[model samples]
Target: MFVAEAAGLDAIAATGTLRVPRTIAHGISGEQGYLVLEYLELGSRGKADLLGERLAALHRCTADQFGFAGDNFIGTTLQPNARTNDWVGFWRRHRLGFQLRLAARNGYGGRLQSLGEQLLGALPAFFAGYSPQPSLLHGDLWSGNHGFLADGTPAIFDPAAYYGDRECDLAMTELFGGFPESFYAAYRAIWPLDPGYATRRDLYNLYHILNHANLFSGGYTTQAEQMMQKLLIAHS
Candidate 1:
């Protein structure tokens, strides 16, 4: 777990867009995984525009295909990132399919499971005209995953990093609302997203929501169902 985290940090830092903590050491300590990182004295929020622009540049980091060289974890859940040339295939199998299957095995059944299966079947329609090349992403970019150093450098940590749709990162930014208008504005100025992002955002986010449902069991299962319902309606 810690090793994968260090690798993700290195990948993001390679982009030289946002700040990433240097992984000093990583190892396993008697049934526990640990990653030691260079501690940064975090301060208040940094410039939103800079964060947005840097994140956009980071997303420009590309790959020959979707997925990492190996599997990693998103939170405690195992995230398989085995390489695939087909973007939708990667998202369907390694992403939504993996999460939904896990959820089902954990006894989450009925409507949420059914709706997720339907959405998985309809995945092709979501990418009808979109042929997205794999882009490096801070796969879990919620509000808590980012901050600023005392020197005002924007640092994002605890990434579930992958080479996939850039919108996945942007979609998670909107999930919890730490990002500001200047952030979106700066990002658009650098790499403008496709017009279909607004429609596809929910589809991307549903993976996270499904994972959350399996992990924490809040109202997330319901949320996933609702999102899929809307998506299925649109596709229909």
Candidate 2:
């Protein structure tokens, strides 16, 4: 896990789009894997607009295919990052499908699995005309993952980095409490999202909530089910 995190930090740092804590070192100490990162004094508030613009710039970094060189973790859950040419197939097979299968393994079945299958089948409808370039992503981007350096520069950390649809990052920013309005406005100002993004946002976010359900089975399972049902209805 430490090694994967170092790789992810390196991937994000390579883009030169945003500031990431430098991965000083990573290795196993005895039976425990350890990662050392450069410390940055972080504050909750900073340049929200700049954060948005730089994040958009980060999204501009793209790959020929979706996924990363290796798999990583999303909050302790193993996240697969097998490269593929098809974005929809990647999401279905690795993101949502993987989580749903894990959920089933963890004994969450019946309605949840049923809705998940339906949502998986209807995935293509959401991307009928949209073919997304595999842009660099901060895979587990949530409000808690970002902050400002003491210099007022926006810095992001704890990445589950991969190359996928840029909107995946944007969708995650909106998942919890959300970033400031300036962040969204600035991002759109630089690279306006597709007209179909509103409908697909929930689809992208479903992967995370499902991950949450798999990681901590309680209200998140219901949330995932509700999200799946809504997605199925939206695209059906």
Candidate 3:
């Protein structure tokens, strides 16, 4: 976990688009593992607009394929990042399909699996003309994962870094509540989202919701099912 985390932090920092706590070192000590990082005093009162602009810049960092050098975790669950040139296939196999299989193994089946399979089959329709470059992503981006340093520079941390659709990062930001309105506006000012983004946002965010359901095993299951049903209906 610590090793993957250090790699992820280094990946984001390499972009130089936004601030991340510098990764100092990571290794196992005795029975425990540790990742040492340069500390920063974070605060919510920092510039939301700046956060948005910088985040947009971060999304500009791109790659040829959709994945990372290796797998990592999304809050403890192993997140597979096998590189692929096909974005839709990558999401279906690595992101959504992987989670659904895990959910079944954890005894969440029946309606959930039925709906998830349908959604997976329908995934191609969501991409239509939208071929996305594999942008560097803060794969676990949510409101809690971002804040500002004492100097008011926007800083994002605890990344599940990968090369995927930039919309994955943007979608996750809106999943758990959301960032401020200024954040969205500023981001659009830098690089406007696709016209189909409203629909695909849910599709991208489903990955995280499914991850949450797998990790916590509570209302998130019902939540993920509802989200899948809603998505199927919308696409249908």
Candidate 4:
């Protein structure tokens, strides 16, 4: 857990990435995870815009290849990253296929599995012409995962850090509401999304929804199914 947290912090602090809290201490006590971090206090709007701009800059820091220097943790499970010059190949193997297989073992069968395969096949079309950089992403950038400093600068925490598409970070923001229009406006002002992103959003978000389904069964299964259905429609 400590190494995962450290990697997360490093990814966020790395050049072209968003700024986040440096973890002072983290450990498991009893049944709960404990962490000590630098505090930042700012409203959602200002912090949102700060995050937006910073994320754009991070995305701009691309590499000729996809994947990271090493593997990291998602929640508690180890996520391996084997380097590849192809973004589509990287996401298909390391992201979608890995998660889908995990979810299937955890009782995610049927349509979800079928849809995942279809999405994998369609990746090339979805991401055509848009080569992504190995941006240092917060990995997990939900509203609850971020905050502001006492001076009102954006401070993010609890990342599933990696070098991948910047949209993965942006898509997580929309998963649970805490961001404002200004944040998106600022992001676009810095780096615009590719034209086909609208079609790809559901596909990208499916990775998270599937992960959530594996982590917490309940409404997440329904949510994952809904997202899969939406992707299938687009594909059809």
The TM-score of predicted model 2 comes to 0.98
Could you estimate the TM-score for every candidate? 0.97, 0.98, 0.98, 0.87
* Model 3 lDDT at residue 48: 92
Q: Candidate 4 — what's its lDDT?
A: 0.76
- The runs of at least 3 residues in candidate 4 whose Cα sits more than 4 Å from the true structure, single-residue gaps closed, are 23-47
Error of 3 at 143 (Å): 1.2
lDDT of 1 by residue, 138-189 (tens): 9999888888876667889998899999999999998876488988999999
**lDDT value, residue 1 of candidate 1:** 82
What residue pairs are clashing in model 2?
none
Model 3 C-alpha lDDT per residue in residues 187-215, reported as the tens digit of each score: 99999999989999999988888888999
**Looking at candidate 4, what is the lDDT of residue 154?**
76
Cα lDDT for residue 79, candidate 3: 94
In TM-score terms, candidate 3 sits at 0.98
Q: Score each candidate by Cα lDDT.
A: 0.89, 0.92, 0.91, 0.76
Worst 10 residues of 2 by lDDT: 227-236
Runs with alpha carbons beyond 4 Å of true place in candidate 1: none
Q: For every candidate structure, what is the RMSD over all alpha carbons to the true structure, in angstroms?
A: 1.1, 0.7, 0.8, 2.8
The sequence of per-residue lDDT tens digits that candidate 4 reaches over residues 116-227 is 7887787787776776777767777888877666565777777777778888888888887647888899999888888777767777777777777788778887887788
